[model samples]
Target chain A: MRAGEIAGRPVVTLDTAEDIAEVKDVVFSHDHGYLVGFTLNKRGWLSGPMKETLDWSGVRALGPDAVMVASGDALAARDAESGATGDAEDVVGGRVITDSGRELGVVTDLVVEVDEQARVVGYEIGGATVEEGPGGDRRYIPLPETFAVSSSALIVPASVTGFIRDDLSGFGSAVDEFRAQLEQTS
Target chain B: MTRFAEAEHTPVYSKASADEIGRVIRYVVTASEHTVAALQVGGRKSKALLADWAHVVGFGPDAVVIDDEEHLRHPDSDYEQRVTAGELDLRGRRVLTDTGYEIGALVDVEFDESTGELTALETDRTSVNGDGLVAIGPYAVIVRQDAVRPEEEPPAS
Candidate 1:
């Protein structure tokens, strides 16, 4: 699923179609460099109005100013292949397993990049600094096309789970070394 | 050359309270000042603080921010460890709540680039957006920099 960078653009759907709020930010994997779920901000008229954010699962289409979803009906409007979303205030915590079965540290938040045009790049994962350290590690887990929202779990394809467990050492000094170089050059 | 520029004489601004100069001169610098020929420095804030800064008009980039010293150190939380890893700074940090307790790190911060204040943080966990999504602000929540912990198995450093 994707949340294109459009400030107030609204996502639309067919019949029981739900409006996939504008893609506030997109999550991407720093390790593999792939598009993940998007962070959306529900449109509102008043200030301090509640904003909504959903996983990339609901999205079925992506357009310039709008995105179409598979189905975003009522309360159960929740379904994430990423697994478990208690709410924006509370997210399902635990390390994520990649499709390759690698360990991707508990997903912490979403990361986004916007250009001058306000165009958004694909979303990236915001990994927590768990019992991990030193930039921890980054892995891009596969995302299912859709998932059923459980009371606590977002419910994603096992294909993703299979890979969320690789050895964290694979990133060794490689990540750090690269980061050092980027800082030096920039 | 810039004030305190490559010169033989010692700099006075550095010796004086740069913070005070900043606090007193914000009106001219932040509000608008084309050229500052020999303006004095303030010692109100810090020389570390820049004269010109950008503001975020709307949603920009996501960044991790640590506010309230209370949250910095909790009863049974290792938040300090996470802060170091995320390299968090108040200038651009993401704020998050963990099961009612605000926790987590900020891996990335978003800015309007144009306006540039700090729109949000690229959070680590996907929290409930209250409505039906996950995000820190308009920005996603990022892992606390300190939370980037050491490996289960230490390498031969």
Candidate 2:
């Protein structure tokens, strides 16, 4: 499920089925790729901080237009009111760097799997110069590699660079090699 | 197999009559299996059309051929409508193993672009190397943990 789908949907209590608030941003574990919970804002309008977060366990049902929760008790304060910002960092524009310091490109998007929870699986990267023009060479980098995400960049190791393929289909060999390398080094 | 991004705008046709129907504006992928469930069709002067993968009979380099235009219809069920409405798109959704291990976010999907048939989901090394997609839902993607290769261990001190 795209993260955008859950945004702005009604957050209802299970027992009361009351529309308590609206879903704001889904807070997920970047490392584990699962839903941690959801941040909520008052229904309508995009102003104000999201003070409440509902854990995934509290979610009873995810419907077409509404998110059903067990109770208002499921709601928890974020960072205990210290103004914890949501993960809205448009990492799409972040730079990509290799462990050997070769600059690859910028992060265009993240590929995730949504089953029991949301998890990040890979990244879409492309050169800054070729992004908008035809024939831009975009590539996908799978997870479990030596990579780091800071304020404005995503860094990977040099070994992972060999796995970079132009398209998903052609990347099969690269994926197998990367997996093999991980097993050997482990 | 074709990427979701490239699958957009691929020409579509009717197999029975071999008449051009429309271009694929977008796709409706299933949440659990990570497969193309339906295609949203659009073209100049044509009414909106949604065709399920079940109706597709063949795929070509230039076109996706469905049984017939009579097979196209607006999604009727809430689940199907949600898929058609982009509410259940798994393209960028995150995934996890049944054991709660972090897999990664879904980056792309590989499928028969012309046939609208889903083939596989590419999430990350864990999900990619796993047996296959076991479940796909709004919450998370689940794969066989046993199928997952062990992560690179930190060097022994």
Candidate 3:
């Protein structure tokens, strides 16, 4: 569990355990450094939120590799049928964390709503971007648009063709669509 | 937009009030910094003049942040997306990195949805020194010089 070494592992129940899928990842609250849910790799292929979720209190132990959860039949997580946050984030940093090896960046800024809720909407990957420019200045990038590339470059979604559109820019159309999509959801 | 303009964003929030909406005090996080300082359901990041920011940014310091209210969807929907996932290539004006190691992870990113400017990148863990912050490698710093296509999100298992 040095770092970024558990991205593809599966969390399975032991022969003696009846419930508790082997933890695939640990999804933390994007804002606070608290454990949120456990992704049971076995259940991630499910359709929707039907995936099980271990309440924040289900965690039993924290280590470099896996966060030990209370073994039980009801330990299913909301996204167990889906996937979730990893242990690397909990053992070392908080959510919205990216670990390739030992590189760590504490989230200092968050782009949220202009309303009272001000809920987190995106992150400013400045910790590592600071060295990507002249004099090593940090460059802002979005998470949905970013992806780890061999732990070196944090590529944005724009760089990846077919993922979205080429001319799409700004929050106008996408924002409207994003909002519209949410309206159609819950 | 300053150095990290993406982090400093501008979103069109509903002209709604949280005064009696039964609010849930949440946190103000950037694109990558999922685990930020704490949770405060004020109007803006500037907790000092929260009263003023409450009016412009939110309804009050207690409004609820329902996805329907803010139109947030999948995965931290409330969190702002300075950039889109399809546009990671630094073709149109993009900031460049130094080390060119491409081994570190992209903890998070910032975007200005208003003008589509990506300004900040939060790394998982970095060593920011006189030469600037680089990905924390076991022995040295990890640098990213070029853009790489994001691989398909593999199955969790």
DockQ of model 2, rounded to 2 decimals: 0.02
TM-score of 3: 0.22
Per-residue lDDT tens digits for candidate 1, residues A104-171, read 45544322222221121111233553344344454433333222222233333334333332233432
| Top candidate, metric lDDT | 2
lDDT of 3: 0.31
The estimated TM-scores of all candidates read 0.22, 0.41, 0.22
Count of backbone collisions within predicted model 1? 103
Give all candidate RMSDs, comma-separated: 20.8, 17.4, 25.0
| Model 2 per-residue lDDT at A74 | 81
Candidate 2 Cα deviation (angstroms), residue A164: 5.2
User: Is candidate 2 or 3 superior in TM-score?
Assistant: 2
Candidate 1 lDDT for residue B90: 23
* Model 2's TM-score against the true structure: 0.41
lDDT of each: 0.31, 0.62, 0.31
Clash totals for all candidate models: 103, 32, 90
TM-score of chain B of each: 0.25, 0.71, 0.23
